[model samples]
Target: MPEGPEIRRAGDRISRALVDKEIVKSNFYYVRIKDREEIVKNKNIKEITTRGKAMLIRFKNGWTMYSHNQLYGRWTVNLNTTKIKSTRALRVVFKTKKHTVRLWSATDIDLLPTSEEHEHSFLKKIGPDVLNESCSYKLIEERLTSKTFHKKKASTLMLDQTVFAGLGNYLRSEILFDAKIHPDDRPFDLDKTRITQWAKSIKNISHLAYKTGGFTVSKYIADRNKENGEPRKSYRHAVFMRYQYECLNCKSRIERKWYGKRKLDFCPSCQIQTGKIKPSR
Candidate 1:
């Protein structure tokens, strides 16, 4: 699944391609929403924005289209003359006179009132988006101290939409590694310095990944790895998929452990824990 930054970047692309442009033609291939295609046809797009992992496409009228690109869902935008060959099922398409914008393999789509876009179930429940300019340190710090989230395990809380909208597996691992905090630790277990690091890391890594196309390591490291002919996986992260590899900071092995259903990567020594963290593939 695409994280918040990825979704936000997609929104930026879609906005440039579709916003202010009239949807001269459109289609809704999903069985349930097929009839709703009429709603998007021939309308001027107002904006495209994202909340967490969901995308909202607003029309000039009082309506907005909501969609979430789960694991396989993708968006393609290009000149109508250009054809994108793909095996993914096409779910939605919006055509402006000069461009063809498509949403493929996505099913979580809905049309709702523009006035109530924020009230949409998925949008309503998610926490502040890291990429949103409104997400300030104070806002994140407040969440860190909130009772509803403070007690949750750091590993679990990182993926909770209500905790940090747009956070997901890979980003979770990178953020934890950057903060040097154990996933098993709750916010309540954090010292003031650790709490600050946690919050800052969330903002920094999310923004960095958004700017660098999902790579979490520093540009210097990434460029160095590239110059050295290292594969992307070797330099794109500090620890995310580098199991059995040396930690960038401490040189300890990057350990991979299963917590619930997701695998978390961390440096056993860099991220301190009193008890042994059971390792699994």
Candidate 2:
């Protein structure tokens, strides 16, 4: 599944291709909204934004188009002259003067008034967006200390979009590994300093992934790994998918535990459990 960074990047691409440009034509192949596609015809796209894994396309008017790329959705942009073979999976098309932007395979789509967008099921309860400039360490720290989320396990909370928008499974693993916090630890189990580190890690790792095209490691390390003939899938992250391998920070073997049906990886020596109280950094 595409995580927050991936979705945000998609939004950036769509924004660059369509924002401010008058849509000469718009097509929604999505069954329910296909007939209502005239709503955006000849209108300018005011802005395009992402909240976690969902994309919002705001028109010059008060309307907003929402789409979630649950698992298979993808968006592609090309010049108007470029030819893309038609497929049954095609979901949306926005043809501007110079470029054609297409959304494929997205099912959870809606068109709603921007004024009432707050009522969206997913957006209504989403926590601070880690990539948003306004979502700072102070905001995350407050959320961490809040009674509503204080008792949840870090492993569980990391995947909870209500706790931190844009955080998914891969991010959950990378952030916890970066902060050197055990997956089993709760916000209440962490000291003030540790909690601060956790907040910082959530922001840093998330932004880094966005900046580096989903890489959690530094450019130097990534380059070194590539030089060693390591595939991106094996080197793009720290503990995620690297289970049973040596940890990047510590030489301890990485371990994976099942959270229901999902997998979570951690380094036993680096991310010490709460009772052990070993400071990682």
Candidate 3:
């Protein structure tokens, strides 16, 4: 699934191609979006930005277009290309004379008045975008210390968009590994200093993911790349997708287990847990 950084990057590309340009044509393949032709036709795109995993296309007339590329959605922007071939469903298209912006396979797309954009059902529920420069560390720390969230497993809390948006399975595992915290550890079990450290890791990894196009390898592994030795693609992450593989730091075998239908990866030695973590494929 595309996370916040990926979505933000896509929005940046689309914005560079279409922002400030009046949409001369618009098309939609999804039934929900087709009826909104009159609403978006000929509207000038004031901005294209992302909030968490959601993409926002704001127009000059106080109307915004929201699109969420859940797990399978993708966007393509083309300039001066006459023909394009795509195997994915061409869900939404916005065209100007010089560029074509397409959202492929996106399941959620809505046109809402600017006054109500904040009140959109999904947008209203999600927390602040972690990739946003203005994302509040204090707010997330408060969430960690909150009575309702304190008892939840750290892994589960990391995946909760309502707590802090834009984290998915891979990022969560990487973040926890970076913090040296077990996925099953309750937030309340961690000291305030440890909670703050984990919070900083979240922001650091989130920024690194944005800057490096989702690479979250440790400095040691990344340094190997600088030494003229290419890190194997299969061993890219410290723990994620490295089930039964040796840990990058301790040499102990990395483990994987199902956490809410999603795989959680970690080194048993690195991520200390209260009880034994049963490993599965």
Q: Pick the candidate with the highest lDDT.
A: 2
Ranking by lDDT: 2, 1, 3
111-173 per-residue lDDT for model 3 (tens digits): 888789889999999877888878767777887889878899988898899988898888888
RMSD of 2: 2.0
Cand. 2 Cα-lDDT: 0.89
TM-score of 3: 0.90
Give the alpha-carbon lDDT of every model. 0.86, 0.89, 0.83
Total clashes for model 2? 0
Residue pairs with clashing backbones, model 1: none
Give one digit per residue, the lDDT tens place, for model 2 in 224-268.
766766677757888888877778777799999899999999999
lDDT: the better of candidates 2 and 3 = 2
Q: Name the regions of candidate 1 deviating beyond 4 angstroms.
A: 226-230, 274-281
Cα lDDT of model 1 overall? 0.86
Clashes of each: 0, 0, 0
For candidate 1, the 10 contiguous residues with the lowest summed lDDT are 272-281
Give the per-residue lDDT digits (tens) of candidate 1, residues 101-151: 899998788888899987888888888998888998778878987998888
Q: After superposition, how far is residue 137 of candidate 1 from its true place, in Å?
A: 1.2
Task: Supply candidate 2's per-residue lDDT for 61.
Answer: 91
TM-score of every candidate relative to the true structure: 0.93, 0.95, 0.90
